[model samples]
Target: MTSSPAAPGSRLASRLGFSDRVFIGRAARRVADQIEAGLDLVENGLAEDLRVADSVADAASRYLYEAGGKRIRPVLALLTAQLGEGNIPAVIDIAKALEMTHLGSLYHDDVMDGADRRRGVPAAHAVWGNSVAILTGDILFSRASQLMSRYGDRAIRLQADTFERLVMGQLHETVGAQPGDDPIEFYINVLADKTGSLIAAATQGGAIFSNAPAEYVEPLRLYGEKVGVAFQLLDDVIDLSAKPEETGKVPGTDLRAGVPTMPYLLLKTETDAASAALAVQIDEGVARIADGEDPAILDQPLAELRDHVVTQKTLELARTWTRDAIDALAPLPKGTVREALTRFAESLADRSS
Candidate 1:
C-alpha cells in the first residue's frame, strides 16, 4: 500500500516543465551535490569531536549518525550561496550548524512524543533510554552553538535568533494542543516555530553568507517560510494518506497522538456534525490507545476521515502555500537557479511522502 520514492531525476523533469527542466536538470544537481558534500563535512566534523569523548559519547554518536532526511536545509544554503559570489566554506559551516540543531531537536522530540521509531528504526530515546537521549540532544545543541560561534559575531547572532525562534515554535505547539485550542491558529503558530524558523534561517543564512542586500534577504526569508509551511502541510497530508512502507512511520500517527494538523482543521470547517463526530472518535481513540486498549476499533473511523475529507483539503492548502512561495521569489533575477527553486517548491506541494 505504500508508495515508492519518485525518481529524483524524473521528478525534477516533470515538475520543472520542459523548458525549465532542461536547465534545472543540470543546475539543481550541481547545487544538491555540493550540499551533500557539505553535509559529509559536518558528519566528519562531529565524528572528530566524538572521538575525544568518553564512552557515553559513543552512544550519542550512534544515535545522531543514523541516516534519514534529504539534507534540504544545507541544499537551500548551497543554492542561496550559488546565487552570489559567496564564501562556500562559511555557508557550509552555518548549514551544518543548522542541521545539528535540527537533529538535536528531533532527538528530544521523539522523547516527548513517545515515538518508538524514526525512519523505520528504533528512535534514540527508545533504544538508549531517556537520560542518554536527552543528554545526547543537549550535546548536539551545545556543539551547534560552538560551531556557529566560530564564524564570529554576526553568525553567532543569527544562529542564536534562529534557535530562539525554534524554541518558541515548539513551545507554541505544546500549548496549542490543549482542549479548546483553535485548530487553524494552532497549526499556523506551531509551524512558524517548528518548521518555519529553520527554513527561514536556512535561506537567510544563505543570503548572509553571500552578503546579499536586505531586499534580497527579506524575499528569501518569506520564500523559505512559505515553503516551510507548504512542506509541513504536505507532511500532515502524508501522515493520513501514506502507508507505513512509504512513510517509514505509522499512518494516522498524528490523530493517534491528538495532534491537530491542517487536515483536521479543514475538516472542522467543512461541517459541524462531521467535526464533532471526528473529535469524539479522536478523543476516544486517544484514550483507548493510551490505556493499552484496542486501537483497531478506531481504524475505520480514521480511514473515513482521511478518504472522505482530509486529503483533498490538505492538498489544496499545500498548493496555495507553494504558490505563495513561488510568488515570493518573483523579485529575484530569473536564472536556472531561480527556476529550479520554483520547481522544487512545486514538487514539495505534490510529493507523496
Candidate 2:
C-alpha cells in the first residue's frame, strides 16, 4: 500500500474523496498515502464481501456494488482514523462494513424512488427488477451484519443501533410529518436519521476502532451528522441546478419522483402574496412532473424557483450547518486530522456535483 505521491492524479489519490484536494498536499503525504492505500484495501475487500455462492445471487448482489460510487462513508471512516492510530486494520474493517451498508441502502432507495440511474449506470432495480434488487439489498445488509459480528458486542451494538436509525429515517420520510410536527424540523430530523446516522457511525466507529481519545468520539459524531445534513441540503439545491452529466441525476429528479426537497419545502412556509403564488406553482409543477408531464413545461417555474428567495435560504442553511460541523471539531486537537477534516467539510459544502 506504499503508493507514494508520484503522480498528482494517480488512481489511488483519485479514489479518496469527492474533492480532488482530499489526498493531495492538504494533509501530510505519508498520512494521506496511508489512508488512500487503506481505502484501496477497503474497495477490494468490498468486492470479496459481496461474493456469493450462486452465480445469479452473486451477480445480483454485486450489481450496485460494482457500479462506482463516491465512497463517502469509507473515506470519512478512514479520515477520522488518522486522528488516532491512522488507518489500522480494524478501522479498515469498519470502513468496509459501513460501505456495504451504504451500498445496500442505495439498492432499496433506487427502487423506492424509481430511479433509473445510479453511479452512472442503470440502477439494480432497472436491470433486475424490484424483487431481485430488494433481495440483493437484504443480502448486502445481512453480510454487513455478519462482518460486524466479527468485532464482537461493541461493533454489533453499534451496527444494530445504526440500522434502526437508518430504517426510522426512511420510515419517517415515507410516512411524512405528523400533526403538530413542524415540516422543516421533521425534514431535518429525517435527514439526521436517514443520512446522518450512518455517517455519525462511520466517524464514531473510526475513533472506536483506531483507539482515538474518547473525547474525540462525540465531537466527531456531531461533525458527521451536521456534515450529512449539509450534504443533503446542498443536494436539494443541486437537484434544481445541476445537469444529469454533472450529478448523475436528472435536474428535478427528486421533485419528479414526488420526494420533498428543501427549496420546495421552504416555499410552503411563505405567507406573502408573491411567495404564496409561487408556492402554488411549485406544488402544481411537482404534481404535473409526477404525472409524467414534459419537464420542459416546468422550466419556467424551475427557473423562477432557482432564483427565488427560498432557494437562497436553502443554500444559506447549508452553509450554516457546514459551519456547525466545523465548530464541532473544536474538541479535536489542532493537527493534521483536524485540518484534513476541516478541508473535507469545506469541499463538500462547495461541491457542484
Candidate 3:
C-alpha cells in the first residue's frame, strides 16, 4: 500500500483518520505521481481563475478557496482522469471549474443557513455581508462557465445542467415538502440534486475530458451521484456526532437551522411516545435557533436524538448508499483507478468531514 506524504496525525492526515487515510493511500498509490501533479495544477489554476481586475471581487472569490478544503471534488476528477491519458490540460481545467462551482455554492449555503463559521473561520456573508457574498458567488459561477466554455458545447451543456440541478435543490429546500410529499424521499432527492450533481459532473468530466471510453461515462456518473448522496448522508450523521474542534462547526448546526437530516427524518417516522416528544422538542429547538437563540439550549435533546435508534438507522443507510456507490463501478475496468474510486467512496462515508 502507498503511504501518504502527509505526516501521521497531522491536520491533513487526521482529516480522514489513520485507517481511512490508509484506504485512500492504497487506492491512489499506483497513480500517486499523477494525483499529486493534478492537485498542484488544480490549486494554481483555481487561484488564477478567482483573480479579477476588481480587487474586491478578486478577494471575495478567493475567500473559501484560500481557507483550504478537503479538495474532494477536484481530486475525484483527477482520479477518474487516470482511466485515460491522465492529467491532461483539459482535465485540469475541468477540475478547477468544478471546484469553483462547489466553492461558490458554499457561499450561498452559508447565507441561507445563517451559518457563522465555515472552515473554522467566519463565513463569507458574516464578514462581507449578504449582498457581497451572493455577488461573489455569482462571480465564481461565471468564472467557472468561462473555464467550461473552452471545452466546447458539450462541457458547457454539462455545466448548465449541473447548475440547474443545484438551484432546484436549494429552491426545493427553501420551499420544503408540499403537504403530501414524503419527507424522506424529498430529502433524499434534495441531497442528490444539491450535493450529487456537481460530484457527478466532476467524475464524468474527468473521463470525458480525458478521452476515456464513452461506456465508462455513465457508470462513473452513477457512481459519482451515489457517492455524493452517501457523502451528504454521512454529513447528516457527522452533524450530530462530531465535536466542534473536529468539524470546525458545532454539532447539530443543521438541525438547529431546521434543516432536515436523515437522523431527524428517521426519528420523525417513529410513533413511540419518547420519539414523539423528542421530535417536538427538536422542532421547538429549531424554531428557537431560527429566532437567533443559542443552539446549546437544545444540548440535552440533541444528545438524546444523537443516541436514538433512528440515528443508528441513518448511519446504516449511509453505509448502504456507500456500498451502492461502489457497486455502480462494477462496469468499469478493474485496475488501480477503480480500486481507488471504491476506496474513495468508502472513505467518504467513513469521514468526519
Where in model 2 is the C-alpha error above 4 Å?
Answer: 1-12, 15-27, 242-245
- Encode model 2's per-residue lDDT on 1-353: one tens digit a residue: 11222334433455534344644464566667676787778877887878899987899887776666667788788878988897777888889889889988999888887877887688888889999899999998899898888888999998999999998999999999999999999999999999999999998898888999999999999999999999899989988884668676667767766788999889888888988887787678877866888766666777777778998899999999999999999989987678778878888777643
Best of the candidates, lDDT: 3
- How many clashing pairs in candidate 1? 1
Q: Report lDDT (CA) for all predictions.
A: 0.72, 0.82, 0.84
Q: Write the per-residue lDDT of candidate 3 for residues 1-353, one digit (tens) a residue.
A: 11122424212233332133433555555575567677777877776778889988877888888777777788778889999989999999999999899999999999998888887678999989999999999999999999999999999999999999999999999999999999999999999999999999999999999999999999999999998898898888888874878765578878887888999999989999999999999899888877988878889898898889987888888889889999999999988788878877777766743
What is the C-alpha RMSD, rounded to one decimal, of candidate 2? 3.3
The collision pairs in model 2 are none
- For candidate 1, the lDDT comes to 0.72
Quote the positional error of residue 2 for candidate 3 in Å: 30
For model 1, residues 1-353, the per-residue Cα lDDT tens digits are 12112324322223222234334566556665554455566555544543425676665644554444555676577567767755466886787788788888888888888888875568888778988888888888887898789889988887888888888887777777567877787787678778888888888788787666666787888888888888888888888764778666567888777777777677767766877788677778878888887766667767777785567778888898889988999888887667767877877765663
How close is each model in CA RMSD to the real structure?
4.9, 3.3, 4.0
The TM-score ranking, best first, is: 2, 3, 1
